[model samples]
Target chain A: MELLRPDSAEAAAAALGNGSVALAGGTELVPLLRDGIVRAEKLVELRDVVPRGVDGTRIGAGTTLAELEVDPDIPQALREACSLAASPQLRSMSTLGGNLLQATRCWYWRLNFPCYLHGGDTCHAKAGQHREHAIFGNERCASAHPSDPAAALLALGARLRTTSREFSLVDLYRLPTDEERNVTALEPGEVILELDVPRPEASVYLKAMERRKWSFAIVGVAAARFADSIRLGLAGVAPIPWALSSVADLEQATPLLGTAYKVQIARALVRRAVEAVSAPAGA
Target chain B: MVVELTINGNAYELEAPVGRTLAEVLRLDLGLTGTKIACGEGHCGACTVQLDGVPVLSCITLVHTVGDREVTTIEGLREHPLVEAFVEADATQCGFCTPGQIVTASALLAANASPSDDEIRHAMAGNLCRCGTYPKIERAIHTVAGDGGGS
Candidate 1:
């Protein structure tokens, strides 16, 4: 029940090194605490440090999803992804760093049910109602990574800068195995300082949702095409956003449940996004 | 921990419990009943409030994170033109989501004095009206936008 408001990222990391979790935006952490999914006795408030340090390509960790939605410097694909994420109010409260680090939104996990992630013997979603769960990378778990912006970030080839180290957006996530519960590969005490989002020549983000607005993606695609290379990212069908090397890679995909239909949707989306971005400026 | 919050231009120092949501502190501790709490999660937008003029969901926002920033709840709203527009347009059907709708719409109008239909729709997409008064709600916002929101 103690909170430490650190003035700098280094101090925040120091507190985190001491076992205090970082709280920013609180869009994800507070709910977990309320639901008893995780317990934290001490917290390091990065409120002062998270909003600083932004450039044309670098976005501060404290930047809210709503801020990213309107930032002109961010690529169109990333902005579109942020805009499509959550509702407006939630976006205003959710930070880019928090969104990337937020836990899976699987109903079983959020409800505090004893599942595989919670140290239960088995993943209940594997056998239970998993229509909204993952379709790819369901080796041991079926929960999909819930962050919409993560897919766009991955497609943009974004790099995460922490207090101590830097890593690609793709390296941040890991599919759960039988032993580990942590989703992100970030080591303890590492505070995400900023995200380096490159402005591609052309990019587009498309999220297939159950609703027109404010629903998680059934299959999200972010495709960015440079003059020389192409980058594609997929969400809602995997434990992590799959940053594919090419469109043909979709053929290697193994879908969970009857959501193989998602592969067709994903293919169409990738084509649409690539076409939208690859089109001439006037065309 | 002692947390200082500036709500409705009034400064108050209160003992904030760790993991306590801003919605709980506002309604339970500070007695600001106007900010409704429907979905305790961040989805509903029923607990929308202005954190330094930006709309945020208090249901998921931790009270300790408020720090010294100003929070504007529906109770603190001072009869703005957006409220009047809602009344004129009969935007409230069930009245449960009206507070959040008005609060969110007010932020939108404040940022863009003349938001178009598409802009209005995108800006207010977060606040759900299960009563299906979205058309009416957008109309109310348009009414205020055309009038410059009473300046």
Candidate 2:
């Protein structure tokens, strides 16, 4: 087993025989190492498979979230979300691909006390203090997924590039099931070459964050414009970014700008996530 | 891991342990010395540096992973106009955050040639000064906008 940062998807695919794990930004991975949750005998670096500058920005799987934040042409809302993902230090090291596939942060999982999230027989967040877990599209594990930009990407109708698969972020966002392989569609060999987003006319990402700098989003919004319509995604509110794509009235998009129902979804999601995980430490 | 990287304009090949920070590599190993290490963690931008033209926290960034990337430290900014302006405005009281401040300020000006006072404040928010010389730093940055080239 050798650590390999392949230059292409084909190379990564060939290297991932069976037990191989995809390594992106090590921000999350390093933490897992500290906690003794997972380990890789062989590492795969995705530096070579970077996206080229073209008509639209093709953010390579390895592109740090900070790099995208500085591009002048990127949508301001998305940029703001990326900027606020964590501290400047973390932003410097973390990548978008890694953010999407991070492990759960539930207290249950953190203490090494096992539940269904790690393939056990029960889910503690279901009837526990699950308030912070999520209200929309939650499952056995009420762990809110880690990516801050995912919500914005879904609303912007971004296209994800992979070695064997490709799709708009919306179609890819079906509710996860027990049979699901991973949170993302990425195979062992596949790499997120770039995320292609069309120009967004109006967008915003409002966040509920702890006073401490490196904390996760307490609750956040990744709302973007459509054809005279609007789609809102709630982050830090669910296991995945909850996209409210069925807003029928296009005119009522920004009710009171920062203080409206569109924004309320993020708050609502937070309340639910907190409810699910509110159990007293153990089962 | 044995990694080869360039700092400012000098090329260096050094053995950096896993979890050994780039900030450590720059200050301890090769002795460039100008880049100070105030906070070992990433909170204080005192250890900030530009990696491939973008400002990043050097403390948390691993040394081995850099792999030939160009790193610009405060030692590299000796003659940069931003440094001169900071000196002209006397933006140094304790002088601890000057390196990080100048490096961060240079990045800001490069991206936005004419930023508003609020924009400048926001850009430098990550880089903190213990003595609160922010007013002087702001004035120094503003000095770059006008046509006057005097100190």
Candidate 3:
């Protein structure tokens, strides 16, 4: 139960050498620690890491979701998705990095069920309640990405600038299978410094929630249109936020039982998001 | 580990466990019962408070992470018109989510004196009221906005 609060990013990354886990915002990590789901002895608090803001095309990973919701420099789709992702209280505490790398919200995992993510041989969601599970990349783990910003980031061509190296935003997550059930590929001691999103011609994010507000996306869509290309990202229907070059790629997605209808919802949302971003002004 | 936090204009150097949540510290250590903890998870805004003038859930907030930020609980709100508006509009049905709702609305009013209906809905989206008093809550917020006592 050792907590290290380093003042600089270098110090923080250096402290994450052993079996320590990085703690940012703690909206996701704290609960897991309290529940005994994660037993890391050391917690490296990254709150003191410098360079936190939403300026120009770069957004510090330490920036909270509340800041992103109102930041003018951010595109409309990212802002909309941020505002709709969680409740006001949660948004104020959840950081951009934590939201991007947070673990699955599946009941089986969070409730300590004997699932593959918990080192069990079988995935309970496949045989149990899986309406909210992934329709793609669900061979061993049926959990969805559960990140609204990740989908929006994928559509906006955002890249993760880590302390060690830079990689595509889509590369952060891995398609979970029995052989490798680890959620993220973030190597030890690698800290997410900031997210770099290239300005796009137009972008939009739309999520279909079970409730009117403050509910996780049943199916979320993020679409961005560049000069002659369009990028689509889908959430709540896959292990990772599914990225596609065009809407026609929807037919190539593998749909699972109990969640096949998500494909239809994703279709409509993708179309609407594309139109919202590509249509002429006041059309 | 010890942490120093300024709550409601008074700085208190409190001794708490490293992993203790702000809500637990407020309720148990400081004896501030106004802040409620419904869902230990961050879903329900029953434990919402103002950290540096922004509404944040105290339940999920770690005690050590608060650092030197100013925390404002329901008890800290001394003379604000939103409190009266809540009573007038009958928004405090069960009074479970009132502190969080008022705190969130205060932040909204601080940022925007007179927020539109859509703005109010979007700002207050995080605080959930199972009592179904949303209409009255919105009315109360509008009532205060109309009074122009924000800030």
Candidate 4:
């Protein structure tokens, strides 16, 4: 295993040319390594390389998710989510970009059961005990978007600032599939330098997991405002952080159960994301 | 490659292989045995240590991830007043979780000198004492934090 530590974001991406690269944070990649879920000949350390700016709350791909929440500028909802996560110790190690890019922690997937997520033909959780899975995009693959910070970012209309390119939240991540490879729209050579939420946006992240600590979500919620429009995103409840139009729009939208708005929005978005996919099992 | 880290006022310039976890570096290589290793995973904070003034798990924390940061182990806190409170309270029944417990408690005190019971519980929740000495642990934390000092 080789350790790659570039001096700058440009250097990092420039180094990532057309090869098997492992983007790491203590949160996602380390656990996968220990679990024997992933093997990498080239291990890149991203924490120190990316520049962190105070004015815009710049976060490097290597910075832990726990560090982001205590940033004082981060929203209260995000702080609560971070505090409620695995623990302060875990938070001290979990990075924001890594959490956002983490693969789904579904039991079937982690257990190496060869489900749809791993390129198998069948999706076990879709028809099985999927209450903990996506509540919305459940037509095929039934895994939840495991990133809690993703929900917060989605609500705030956060964007990814890649080393050589840039894309909005909706653009960067791969479209989710209930039956095939689920990925954020990250290309092979691209390195995530920093994630950006505009200075004007206010956002919050919430998740109802099984335990007090170290558990994934059963139902997650994030609400934020962008260009004066509030968007609500759900995690542990859909394929992506289930995005919806402003709550005011929903109130003005075809009136139904107020409690059922999240579920309905999740169902709608999940269908759209799955419908937009073109790959077979794993692309 | 060779990486130098300042752990608990002692400078360790060691060779860390690619993807070497911090837990392995501390207990296995450094001979600083105060930091315990229960779960190799991030959960179950038996490997908690103070890094750059914040409490973090050593198991998942890679040696390469944190560069040139100051690390405070449980052994370093031996002369601390909090440890005295812990001993007075008899907080450790099995003694396995004490190192992590002391590291976490020191971090909590450093951040907030007079944390409430809820705050103490919240900070210590990550460090699980399977021996179930929570009551005395809570009392010890309160005592060292100068709240109750366990009567």
Candidate 5:
């Protein structure tokens, strides 16, 4: 394999496609590559190619989760999400962009099972062990989106700029379709450049995990309060980070046999997240 | 690819594949067996190493992507207080995860000299002790940090 270290973002974008993958922090991509889940003939390094650091409400895509966790300028929900997303070592090596693009933690997919996401006809988790699978949007696939920060960003009403165009962060994710098995809306060779988040009046992120620390969320909720409205985003509930129109919409969940318990967890977290964000400052 | 890496304060030019992990290059090529590789994936912290003083999973970090950065393994932490503290505190069981644990703890204490018990747990959360020697590991870190130790 060839390692291409492009000095600029344009060069990095140009180097992508045609059997080449973009390398950012290498937290997610490297493991997939090593396990033969994803294949690439070349890796285009983006450490130096993409921008870093925060300028007002705009954050560079190259910012590490550790850096995002402590930056005073970042919103409280995003910082908390970044801190609670992974272990210390992983946060130090994972970038915001990479975190958003990370694949699900479904063992079936990671183990190379012929699931729907792997271009197979069956959703393995739906018929097999799916205790950690999705509770919503699981008609076709049972895998849940594993990103904590994506949920927070979705609640923050974040927008992002790519190499070719700009769009809301919500547009960045989609449920896997028969034509495209991938969950993300990003086309081939497209690269995320940066994100712009509007400051919320108040925000809170709550997550429930199997372990006390360093475990993926069984149900994560991000609630952001604005001047006259509130937005909630959920993780570990669907194939994509799910945005809730209202808390009542959670009732629309159609859980699998083994995943029925997640609906209760999501309800509890969503309640607490809403209460926390709804409280007055310092309450 | 020929990559220039600075490991343990020494610079060396090594030829390795672009897909080869930093842990593989350290163990198989440079013969630095101090850095253990248990999972080969980033799930286990057994392959933890310091990249420019920040703890990172060397198993997932590509060797070619580590250009011009200093890599520090357990061997680089010679005579560090945590090493002795680990012995006095009995922080090892099979000693397989010792190097990764010490490397991670050292970085934590470097940034915060007087971390609370909660801070210590949060920082050391990644380095799993399958033998359940967590209390002793926390004690060792606290001992070096000049604290009485955690609850």
Candidate 6:
């Protein structure tokens, strides 16, 4: 185990390869490493490598969730999503970039079960206990994307800049395929640098969690109303942060036996979120 | 890796692995056992500590990533009003979650001297009391906030 503290983003990107992992706030990666769920020969610390703070619509990826939640300049959906994502301690320690890359909270995966995500033949949750599993895109894996902010960013039509290229946030995620078991579309050595979010006319995020505070969403929805269009993104429904063409898309879910109840929660949340963002100012 | 850490107003040099968490260093190496590690993951705030005055879960925070920021543990909060308040308000059951609870509540009160009841609940939501002593904990925080000296 080695620690590489690169002073530049280019250097940090260069250092990440061949079993070396990037360390942001260590809120997600460290625990995975400790539990042996993820293995790395070296850790490239990004505290000094990546940029921080917000400049108009450009938010540096190193910005912490706590910082984003309270920044008045940040969009309402993103702020609310960050606020509702995790506990106070975790929000203070987790970065926006790292939050986007966090793995699923499925106990089967975290417990080192031989699931498809772990390169095993079977997705344990598909046949086993899947109360918290996905209601959509569960053909290959039953895990739900656990990031609340990623769904909000998807609704806001956010674009991300990496060390190599820039792309829409929607392109940053994909359902796990047989060839590639990972959910994210990021290349191995590329580092997330910043995010550009276009301001919307109105936006809101609503989450349904098992507990009132400090719990992962059972169904999360983010709605962003643009000049001519409205976009809705969902979390805890699919292997990736799910974007909906319309509220009717909620009907397309293929839920497992234990996860059938999530479809109702998704439909209700989608309707309410869209309604909240669509309402007139001060209405 | 040899790292220099500023903890509880003192600077110390030590050799630790890159993957070693700050909670491990605080409890095992430095003998600051006041910081508890309940869930080695970040789910539990039992390892809550101050990183430059902001409450963070030390269980998941890598010691090597701490840099030059000062780390304050429950031991660092000597004679703080919250300690006495927790006792007077009967906030502890088994006392395992007290250090972490006090550390988190202290940070909240420091930022907002007169936080509303809702504000207190929101801030202290992370630090779980398995004994279900939340009402007492809220009262203790309110007592220190000078809010009518607790219910």
lDDT of each residue in A128-179, candidate 1, tens digit only: 8787787678777788887778998898999999988999988999877776
Model 4 segments more than 4 A misplaced:
A17-24, A57-64, A127-131, A175-180, A199-203, A225-228, A246-283, B149-151
lDDT of 1 at B84: 83
Worst 10-residue lDDT window, candidate 6 chain B? B142-151
If you assessed candidate 6 against the hidden native complex, which CAPRI class would it receive? Answer: high
lDDT of 2 at A255: 27
lDDT of candidate 3 over B19-41, digit per residue (tens): 89999999999988899999888
Error of 2 at B54 (Å): 1.8
| Docking outcome class, model 3 | medium
- lDDT score for residue A50 of model 6: 90
True-vs-predicted CA distance for residue A159, candidate 5, Å: 0.3
Ranking by DockQ: 5, 6, 1, 3, 4, 2
Whole-model alpha-carbon lDDT for candidate 1: 0.84
lDDT (10s digit) by residue, model 2, range A1-283: 3457777767876776465655565666644654566666665666556554334555565667777677677876678778777756467677876666665566676656566656675657665655456544554556666567887676567788777777787655444567762455565566666677777656766667654344566667666664455666666655566676553322333322222343365545434433332343553
User: What is the TM-score of each predicted model, taking all chains together?
Assistant: 0.94, 0.71, 0.95, 0.83, 0.98, 0.98
Best first by TM-score, ranked: 5, 6, 3, 1, 4, 2
lDDT tens digits by residue: candidate 6, B4-120 = 999989999999988788999999999999999887788879999999999999989888888889999999998899999989989999988899999999999999998887888
DockQ agreement of candidate 6 with the native complex: 0.92
Write candidate 4's Cα lDDT for B1-151 as tens digits: 7878888798888898867878899988988888989977877788888888788888888887667779999888889887888789999898988888888888888888998877887778788889999899889988877766544
Evaluated on chain A only, model 4 obtains a TM-score of 0.78
4 or 6, greater by DockQ: 6
Over 4 Å off, model 3:
A279-283, B147-151
DockQ winner among the candidates?
Answer: 5
Candidate 6 residues A187-229, lDDT tens each? 9899999999999989999999998899998989999999868
Q: What local lDDT score does residue A58 receive in model 6, on the 0 to 100 scale?
A: 95
**Which 10-residue span in candidate 1 chain B carries the lowest summed lDDT?**
B142-151
lDDT of 3 by residue, A132-236 (tens): 888777777888889999999999889989888999998898887667777788987889999999888889899999976788999999988888788888878
Higher-ranked by TM-score: 2 or 5: 5
TM (chain A), candidate 2: 0.80
**CA lDDT of every candidate:** 0.84, 0.67, 0.86, 0.69, 0.92, 0.91
